[model samples]
Target: MLPWIFIGLALFFGVFWFSGNAANILIIYVIGLTGMGVFLVLTSLTISKQSNLLKKAFETEKNYPPLLVKAILLFAGIGMLFGSIRYWQDVPFYQDQNFSVISGKPSSIDEYNSKGTVTELYVEIKGHTFVLDADMPQFPKYKKYEELLDKHFTILYLPNSNWIIDYKVE
Candidate 1:
């Protein structure tokens, strides 16, 4: 029961992690789907072990349905297949097309909002943009970014997909 609850929570987290991340699906898909696959595998293993123990103790296989274990394993396999597809999608075929950082001047910062002084930053690496995740409670927008229009920053991105991996103030 508790495991099911955690799985639900993971699914919710995956949703938030995937928000505004369609172009940069690697972060959410790789971590979230892999976690889902691992959880499914664990469920399969635990169910099998429990069934085996029950069989040995009762001297009969009637205690638990054998199909239950097989079902869990089947779901695990399917989930892992989906995860593998996402994991392999961004794999680079060329050196220059891999992860690269573009260092240049930040042209502008728009749509600025602050919550009682806390600020959230959005990074536009290549063409993809996403909110910079940080300690939310202590969210701080750098003065250089807001005050100076020509602040220097480095954008880490994938050349082929033109997806922004990350960015940092320089």
Candidate 2:
């Protein structure tokens, strides 16, 4: 019973740590690793405590159902591991993001993306190739943001990603 309480508290704290940064990939990865660590610790503690209990009480209590606990912990630990793997794959690229301002004409303009209202506009910046979200702050600066197919522009990208931090119509 005590061990199960400890395990529950650990899992709760793990979620509390992640709730604040649910949108942050790196934070999510850290939480996943931490949650798995907590699960392992609780499992070991439960095993040790079970051995120390008197025979009759141990037999009667059957306190924590081993199979049920194992299944729950295994499910949570595996879920966290998968999250960590996804974020881990991006770590190498994130470390070497280019910081220079780049310029080029978009080869294509994607209109009618349904992100918010059935297909918003997007511009594929030639140099970076990632479609910059047309609804971003810089959209108003473009005379007709969606008409970027042939126009040239300078774009600032967020480090290590295709996301445009800002843009200038040249």
The segments of candidate 1 whose C-alpha lies over 4 angstroms from its true place after superposition are 1-29, 34-88, 91-97, 111-119, 125-130, 136-141, 159-166
> What Cα-based lDDT does every candidate model obtain?
0.54, 0.55
- For model 2, the run of ten residues with the poorest summed lDDT: 20-29
Q: List the residue pairs that clash in candidate 1.
A: none
**Tens digits of lDDT, candidate 1, 86-153:** 34555552223567667765444544466754345664544555454444333335555455335566
Query: What is the clash count for each candidate, in the order shown?
Result: 0, 5
TM-score of each: 0.39, 0.39
* Candidate 2 lDDT (Cα, 0 to 1): 0.55
> Which digits, one per residue and each the tens of the lDDT, describe model 2 over residues 1-170?
56667667666757744652343344444554656556655654465424435335446556465544555666665666565564455455445654347778777665564655523456666444655444455553434545666677787654443434457765
